[model samples]
Target: MASLTIRQLDKSYPLAKGARNLVLNKIDLTLHSNEFVSIVGASGCGKSTLLSIAAGLEEFDSGEVLVDDQPIQGPGIDRGVVFQSYTLLPWLTARQNIEFALKSAGYAHTERAEIAQQHLELVKLAHAADKWPAELSGGMQQRVAIARALSYRPKILLMDEPFGALDAMTRRQMQQLLLEIWETHRLTVMFVTHDIEEAIYLSDRVVVMKPAEIDQCIDIPIERPRDFSVTHHPDFLNIQSQIFERISQPLEHA
Candidate 1:
């Protein structure tokens, strides 16, 4: 069954002279249960905007977005979002940050601590659970953000370049950790990124978008439990090259 469905979505922003700036146009996408889908495109392609809309953090001008067949009205516990920024509360420890989300989602106060600790360990951050965002590394902070998002057990995880600010090594580590989390939880994920390799490596399908609409939906076809070694494989390189070509093509011709 489809976990998230977006149909003919249209969004626009008002311009200076009362003109409308079209952002997303006639966008349609459907993500099945436990599927990992990534959206990649050039800057100004409305990638983040689409993700925000899915998170119910932004409104659309037309069309419909649904979670399990129910139209999205606004932000809810059903959708969890993580952005490029770590977004952790500076005053809270890693564990407290996740516990905050759990509390807001109506989890029992007594159980929140244990649940938060479990999620921290899920992201391999149990060792740093007591550390504040300032004391932790960038990667660690993002892991905490992810743990907080998942702590509520949202139906879908919406990530907008969640690792964009991390170092290369940390980015790779987070990607591996995310893959493991998705596999373990059987999550339905919608990821947005500018990194082609990251998208291909983590996604079952890549949705290539133009300025306001989807250009193509490319299947990775790579076997799972993937590791760093898969990056050097011939199939991986070929798929990367193809996505690059699509991304580099002119918008009018795309």
Candidate 2:
């Protein structure tokens, strides 16, 4: 488990022939060990950018990312990232893909296989372990991607729209799967998505981001081991409504 601190985080991109554009501004947030945090916002809200920076995939102009009071210098096993696109190797089977990550991480051959199988089972993809990415459906491919990410045993899982490519039904299944894994592993998770319902259903707290800044954060406060039944609960909609209100707020012109 790891705790995170982001203080005055800022990111900017240089224009083609002019001044740089500020993407993130003075963003400060904390994620406790084993906490599940979800971020939702508008299209250009820098949600993904923030996740990338936190994962050490991208650099920021200012501020710091600290884990367990230590600085995050670059991508490490402590932070695993899963993007919307399933970044699996088509030539490798699901089990093989996960094993490769373990091998690169310096796990012994016997240990690598054991860890790979364990994660595949965790994601309920054991049946498809032998199948190559091309043979798996979109959802199954993502399951393999998830299995690989988990095999590394990262303390924090940074997911950016990981289910955006799935159909509605598959999306629901994936959400439940993710929640189950999260509950079992108790890893710190920071997920970014545009779907309010998804954010509300899976997170301990929803961090709502505006175009250039974080707007508000709402605690879910619902009991854990969540499922589709959560949508029927009155409290669920109350949180959903709260998120909607934040999203619909108008941004003042710069």
- Which tens-of-lDDT digit does each residue in 1-254 have in candidate 1? 23999999999999998999999999999999889999999999999999999998998899999999999989989889999998889999999999989988999999999999999999998999999899999998999999999988898999999999999999999999999999888889999999999999999999999888898999998998999899999999999999899989988887
Candidate 2 global CA lDDT score: 0.90
Which candidate leads in lDDT?
A: 1
In order of appearance, the predictions have TM-scores of 0.97, 0.96
Pairs that collide in candidate 1 are none
Error of 2 at 233 (Å): 2.1
Cα lDDT tens digits for candidate 2, 1-254: 98888989999999988889999999999999999999998888899999999999999999988988899989888888899999998888999999998888778997987898898999898898899889999999988888888788888899999999999999999999998888888999999999999998999999999986988988998998787898989999988988888787776631
User: Which portions of model 2 miss their true places by more than 4 Å?
Assistant: 16-18
Runs of candidate 1 with Cα error greater than 4 angstroms are none
